[model samples]
Target: MSRTLIITNDFPPRSGGIESFVHELARRRPEGSVVVYCSSPAGSDDAADPHFDLRQPFPVVRDAARVLLPSPRVAARARSIAALEDCDSVLYGAAAPLGLLAGGLRGRVRRQVALTHGHETGWSALPGASTALRRIGDTTDTVTYLGRYTRRLLSRALSPAAAVRMRRLAPGVDVERFRPGAGGGEIRARHGLGGRPVVVCVSRLVPRKGQDTLIRAWPRVLADVPDAALLVVGDGPYGPRLRSAAAGMESVVFTGPVPRAELPAHHDAGDVFAMPCRTRRGGLDVEGLGMVYLEASATGLPVVAGDSGGAPDAVLEGETGRVVDGSRPGPVARALIGLLRDPDRAAQMGARGREWVARTWSWEHTAERLDGLLGAPGRADA
Candidate 1:
C-alpha cells in the first residue's frame, strides 16, 4: 500500500473548506496509510480525533519563541516527512507557508504535488500579512487549480515548468450526506419559514464573499417576489456589519455559524442558492469556486452566482444555474427574480444541477483521481 502525507495549514479542529477537503481525502484513502500535518492557532484545546488516524498536531505560529518560524516551518515539516519511515509522497494542501516549505524540499522528497484553491492565487495581494505567505506559496512544483480560470492565473504567475504542472481538479462533495431528497421541510419548519421561497447563501461572512452585495440586492428581490426569504448561513469577521445591513429587512434571516453536520439541512431548506462573490480592491478578496455551490447543487437547488474567480466552473450559465456579471447588484437581482418568478424553470434547473453533481462531483471520484496520482512510479510510497 502507498503511504501519503498531507501537509495543510488548517484541519478538522479548525473549520473551513480547506480543512474539510483534507479530512474527506484522508477518510477515503482507507487502503493507504494517510497522515495529516496541520497548523492551528496557539493554545487550541481541540485534539485530533482518533477515528481518522491523523498525526500529532503541529502549530503554525505567528509569534516568537518557536524553534523554527513560519519561514522554516516547511523545512521542519520536511524533516518530519523524512522521519516518516515508509512514506512515499507528500501532498501539500495549498501553497504559501506550506507550499514554500514543500518547494524548498523538492530535492529531498521523491515526489511533491501542490493543490491550489482559487482565491489563494487570484486574491493573494489583499491587505494583511498573508500577502507575504502567498508570495512564498507561489513557488510549488505541481499546482492543482479548482477551475480553468485559476489554472490560467497560476500559469501566468509561475514559470513554464510550474505552469505545465498545474491541472484543474474540481472539489468534491459527500453526495450521500448532502442529497436532495433529505429533510427539506424539517429545516424550513424549524426556522418558521413554512412554504416560503428560501434563497440560501452559505459562506464565511467575509468581505469577498459578497454577502453585503446579497444584502443590498435583497430589497429588490423581495419586491419582485414578496414571499421570498433570504437565509444567510455561516459566520465570520463581517457578521456584525451584515446583520446591521439586514436590520430592517423582515424577509432576511441570518443563521450564524451553523455546524458542519447540520449544513445539509440548511442546503435542503433553500429553493435556490445565491453566491455573489466578487473581487475586493487591492486583490484582497475573491471567491474560490465556493464549495457551497456544489453542496446546494447536489441538493437540487438552482444557483445564482457572480461570474468571478472559480464560480463559473460550478455554475453552468442558464443550464444548471445563472452566472451574472459581478460589477453591480442589478444583474444579481434580475437573476434571482427570474428564477424565483418561474418555479417550473427553477425546478428544472435544480434537477439538472443535482444530476450533474451526482454524475461528476463525488468524493469517491475525487479520491480515485488522487489515488491514481499517488500510484504513479515515484509517488508509490506516498
Candidate 2:
C-alpha cells in the first residue's frame, strides 16, 4: 500500500473552499493509506477524527507571524506524520505557510507535490518571504493547479520544468449528495420561503465574495421580481458589514454559517445561484475556481456569477448560467432577472448543467484521476 500525507492550512471545523476540498479528498481516498496534517485553529482539540486514518494538528500563527517565521512547529509535525505512516508522497493543498513546511521537508521524503486551489502564484506576500517560498515551490518535483488560470499564473512564477509539471486538476463535487432532486421543496418550506423564487449565494462573507455588490443588485432584482428572495449562506468577518449593508431588505435572509451537512438543502431551495465575486481592493483576493458554482450546477440550478477567475470555465455563457462583468451591477441584475422571468429556460439550463456535472466533475472521477497520479512510479514520496 502506498501511503500519502496531505498537508493543508485549512481543514474541518474551519469551513472554506480549500477546507472542504481537503476533507472530501481524504474521505474519498482509497482504502488504508492516507493521513492529513493541518494547522488547527486556536483552542481547538488536536485529536484525530476516527474517519481519517491520521490527523495531526499544528499550532497556527497569524499572517504576520506566519510570514516572519515560515518554518514553525508545523514542519516538525508534518515530518513526524510522514515518518510514522511511511508515506510515499506529500501533497500540499495550497502554497501557504503550511506548504513551506512541506516543501522544506522535501529531502526527508521520496516525492513531493503541491496543489494550487487558486491564486498561489499571483498572490503577493511580504517581499522577501514571498520570493523565498516561491523559489522553494518552483523547485518541488510536481505541482497541480485547480484551474487553467492558476496554471498560467504558476507557469509565469515558477521555472520551466516546475511549470511543465503543473497540471490542471479541478476539484470534484459529490453528485449524490448535491443532486438536482434532493431537497428542494423541503428546504424552502423549512426556511419559510414557500413558493417564493429563491436566489442563493453560498460563500464566505468577504469583500472578494462581493456580498455588498449582490446586496446592491438585490434592490434592482426586487424591482423586477417582487416576491424573489435572496438567501446568503456561510459567514466570516464581514458578517456584520453584510448585514448592515443589507438592512431594510425584508426579502434578504442571512443564514449564518450553515454546516456542510445542511448545505445541500440550501442549494436545492434556490431557483438561481448568484456569486458576484470581484477582485478585492489592492488585488489581494480572487476566486480560484469557485467550487460552489459547480455544486450549484450539480443541484440543477442555473448560476449568475462575475466573469472573473475560473467562473467562466464552469458557468457556460447563455447555457448553464450567465457570466457578467464584475464592475457593473446592471449585467448581474439582468441575468438574475432573465432567469426569474423564464422558469422554463432556467430549468432547461439547470438540466443541462446537471448532465455536465455528472459526466465531468463528479468526485468519483476526481478520485480515479488522483489514484492514477498517486500510483504512478516516481510521482509520490516513496
Clashes of each: 7, 5
lDDT of each: 0.72, 0.74
Q: Model 2 residue 47 lDDT?
A: 40
- Candidate 1 vs. truth: CA RMSD? 4.6
Q: Write the per-residue lDDT of candidate 2 for residues 1-382, one digit (tens) a residue.
A: 7878877666665557777777677777766666766554434323424323234232222221212234656577667777887887877776654556655687777767667766664453346545644675665666677766666665665666665666556689888988877777887877788999999998888877777788888899999999999999888899999999989988998988776788888899899999988765444466777888888999999998886676677777788998887767788889899999999999999988888888989888877766765655334211
lDDT (tens digit, per residue) of candidate 1 on 285-308 = 566677888899898899988877
Relative to the true structure, candidate 1 reaches a TM of: 0.86
Position 180, candidate 1: lDDT: 81
How accurate locally is residue 85 in candidate 1, as Cα lDDT from 0 to 100?
A: 37
Instruction: Predict model 2's lDDT versus the native.
Output: 0.74
